[model samples]
Target: MSATYDVYIKKLTTQELGYRKGRLMTGGYFYISKSAVGSFFKELDKYVLNDFLRLDFNDPLEPGNIIQASYVYHNDKYAKENGTRNEYRIYHNRAIAKHQLHFQPYEIVVFIKDGDDNYRIEHYTRNDKAYRILENIIEDSKIRGQHALLQLSEYNTLLNV
Candidate 1:
């Protein structure tokens, strides 16, 4: 869709905060942060690498269309040995290929939590309003980049939802 918004608010992802150059992460798996995500993720087998929670997302970029993704939580012994925090990953190459949802280096992906197991995913460039806002937050609060959970909105309350 390649659309830019001076004020853009789309569906959310790993929602809030931002990711940087290494979003593709290791392998083709794309990851995000997990919060008070409710039963969908909460019930997932957190320590089981093979266990996954699924969601069907309505892509905001392409209205009225649904994209399916398989989400997995990594919090097992392997994760601890790797010194990684609890995180969520979506098998989204299908979404990327089918709907052109590419997360290039220094780009932004906003995952909006919709319901118990629903979300609105958004994409933006580093220079776009989304990235700039998160960038400012990162700079101002010294939030680490590249998959660091954005600890926003206690004092900030940046996005309405």
Candidate 2:
């Protein structure tokens, strides 16, 4: 409404989209980009750094029903010790299995932070009008190869962060 806003737009990769093994959705996780993760979230009080916390997210597609996702964190510190740097990733959920969220590879996944642990998630393909609008709004410079954390204002805002 005003000028600046907090938003995360990710152009999904094939691995990020997961595959359908004869109708079974397998091997996909909603990974939170560190570039986009600023102060959008409050203090990490809901879940521990290295723990599985059940997250019941609101899905507009399924009215009166919430999709579930396990919030998981793999700290960067572990990367130094031979683990991994996937600090913010949400996996092992029922959203895909239950068809609560529709998505595909190369489509963009949007995260508009309404509050801590609360966001309006949207998926858009390249052919979508909304995606075209976003294409004009999200500048080429802001994106890092495939994905980048982005923010837009009321005027289809586009600028380098």
Candidate 3:
């Protein structure tokens, strides 16, 4: 079944850096760092403003889904023996020609549902890290058959959105 939700993005406060810190459109506040805000806007300008971003939420893991988001896998054996090394693997659908340039690992990816009812990767981080937290969250969401809502608190966990 298809679902619709009212999504809003807000800058988070520094004091509470752990929690998701946002309400369901009520009176609660969400906090994000100034640098994060700047990065988000910069991504927006590059992706949304340039019309490269689209939101197609048919099924993130489905092969038919045009947009695919994944993470770079760091093999422990390779890392320990050969020094740090990583490999990017597409988690959901296979990467097509259109998404070859954008779909990558170690980035904070934001998948949105566009006006045409298509899904796309909106935002992502540039740096690659050992821990693919976002990719894990997305995989968990697929397993649970629900949207992933990341909780950035002391006990960082993925909540169903």
The reply for model 3, stretches above 4 Å from the true place, is 1-102, 105-109, 118-120, 123-133, 142-161
Q: Which digits, one per residue and each the tens of the lDDT, describe model 2 over residues 10-60? A: 676556557565342566777665444433422233233464556555685
| Model 3 agreement with the true structure over 1-161: per-residue lDDT tens digits | 22332221221222222223432222211222222222221122221211222323444345455543322233343435444433222233334223323332223444333434354443434443412545555455432321243222411232222
| Best model per TM-score | 2
lDDT: the better of candidates 1 and 3: 1
Error of 3 at 47 (Å): 34
Candidate 1: TM-score?
0.57
Model 1 scores worst on lDDT over the 10 consecutive residues at 1-10
lDDT of 1 at 158: 65
Q: What TM value does model 2 have?
A: 0.66
RMSD, every candidate, angstroms: 9.0, 5.7, 18.0
| Candidate-wise lDDT, in order | 0.50, 0.57, 0.32
Native-referenced Cα lDDT, model 3: 0.32
Better of 1 and 2 by lDDT: 2
Candidate 2 Cα errors over 4 Å, as ranges: 1-5, 19-25, 41-49, 52-56, 76-80, 96-101, 136-145, 148-152, 155-161
lDDT of 2: 0.57
Better of 1 and 2 by TM-score: 2
